[model samples]
Target: MKAIVTPGPRPVTDPSALLDIDAPEPVLGPRDLLVEIRAVGLNPIDFKVRRIREPGETAPDILGYDAAGVVTAVGPEVILFKAGDEVFHAGQINRPGSNAERQAVDERIVGPKPRTLNFAQAAALPLTSLTAWELLFDRMRADPDEEETLLVVGGAGGVGSALIQIARAKTRLRIVATASRPETREWCLDLGAHAVIDHSGPLDEALTAAGERAPKYIASLTQTPRHFEALVRAVAPQGVIGMIDDLPPGPFDSLKSKSVGLALESMFTRSGQGTPDMIRQHEILAEVAALVDAGRIRTTLTEVLGPMSAATLREGHRRLESGTTIGKLALTGF
Candidate 1:
């Protein structure tokens, strides 16, 4: 099959950061489903993995995490889906990704595509949705009936967009999202955020100005280290705070006063560490798919660059790094 592969680690500016070349199509394991990809979404992982995975290490590496496609065939042990099924998935980070004409995915981590969404739109959701879903339910332990509120930092990105909608529809939590620009603020509101505050100032003041009595749960998506002190103040006593990014400096002194619990939300942890709930990704995506099909959740796709190629993939990487994009960016078809 024709696909894009990373021959070796290279700078994004390097012509060889990604290469469009012919590679052997992947064969599926008994627990896997081979999908003919129609649309693929770009995530931060696409760029981060470039320097981490070396070429000619057992097999060449491909980079893309979220995909929407059709099931062309399923392995012998597969039963949940069959040929011609429409699927979408935020695939595992430990394997070859969906940046090609065909991808082999574990059925356990794949989900049914929202009936209302096209391939591109569906492609934009999985990774972010998975992260947001796990962050709210598994980490924060938010209750649907509780009136506690959640304050999200960096609210216009992919996971932030998904987080706002889920918190709004699934829980009574008054959701307030922090965005620095007028467009982003409007985007967050449109995505179901009850209030949108500027992330540029002191978070405590920002939340207060947004009519928040006190945010009892907070999800910090970016700049977690810099916002650590502010997050401690903005959250209520005994509140919970979750972060998804890499390590940042922290004494967590502020949390000490409130008896707060801090958790890190890494979507790939289950797969990376071989956790007992390794199959939970499949379960979560299935439910998320049902919610999307029922119109409770919508696709976060905002940019469709059309088709896949090294040049196009590079541009998608460029747009993500530029940090001006709202929601998600997808490339459709081969």
Candidate 2:
């Protein structure tokens, strides 16, 4: 199998940050689906893992999570899919990833690919969709029927794109997203955000100027620490804040005064801990696929780099690291 891997955990600008090489076929487990990967989505996790070396890690670590492909073989214990089933999944973080021509993923975490989308489109969804779903429904415990306001920070990126659409499609939340640039702001609105605020500006001032009320929920997707104080001020008392970023050193003790709740949403938690609810990812992806097929939502894939290769993957990482991509980036075929 052809694969792209980092020679070591180095910078994306490093010549050997990603290299193409032939790798042995992934070994399948009892519940695994051996997929012939047709498309792969690039995420920040891929780049982060590439640039950070752990103490006991080896070279050429495969680094991808989102993939859309066809099952070429199924493990002996698999029941949900067959050899010819089309599937999409964000594979486990603990195993070899989806950066190759073939990958072995647990069937319990995979979903049927959206029939309305092609390989690249479907590939762009699983990871971001799972993250947004978990953040909104599980972490924040949002009421789907309640008319609440959701403030989504960093609203032009992949996960933000998914979050806006899902909130609009599945809940009554008045979606207000943060995007500094005009293009990004427009992109968020197009994806179903009711309003766009500039994260680069003062959130309180922006919300007040826009006639937006204090948000009942905040999805702090990026720079959470930088905007933590602002969010604390802008969110309604007793509001919920779910973040996916690493916070800077400090106590979030301010959340105490308002009795505000905090939660962290890491999509990998289930697989990372071998939790019993790991199959919930499959359920979320399936729901997302149904939404896509019914035209209630659309794919967030805005760019497709060429076929999977070291150069293309590196360039994708460069764009993501620049923190300027509007939506998802995918690569189709070998």
C-alpha RMSD for every candidate = 1.4, 1.3
lDDT against the true structure, per candidate, is: 0.86, 0.90
Worst 10 residues of 1 by lDDT: 51-60
Q: List the residue pairs that clash in candidate 2.
A: none
List, residue by residue over 89-146, the lDDT tens digit for candidate 1: 9877777789988889888788888888889988998899999989999998888899
For model 1, state the Cα shift of residue 40 in Å: 0.2
lDDT of 2 by residue, 65-173 (tens): 9999999998899988999989999997778788899999998789999999999999999999999999999999999998989999999988999999999999999
Give the TM-scores of the predictions, in the order they appear: 0.96, 0.97
Any runs in candidate 1 off by more than 4 Å, and if so which?
none
lDDT of 2: 0.90
* Deviation in Å, model 1, residue 219 alpha carbon: 0.5
Highest lDDT scorer: 2
In angstroms, give how far residue 154 of model 1 lies from its true place.
1.2
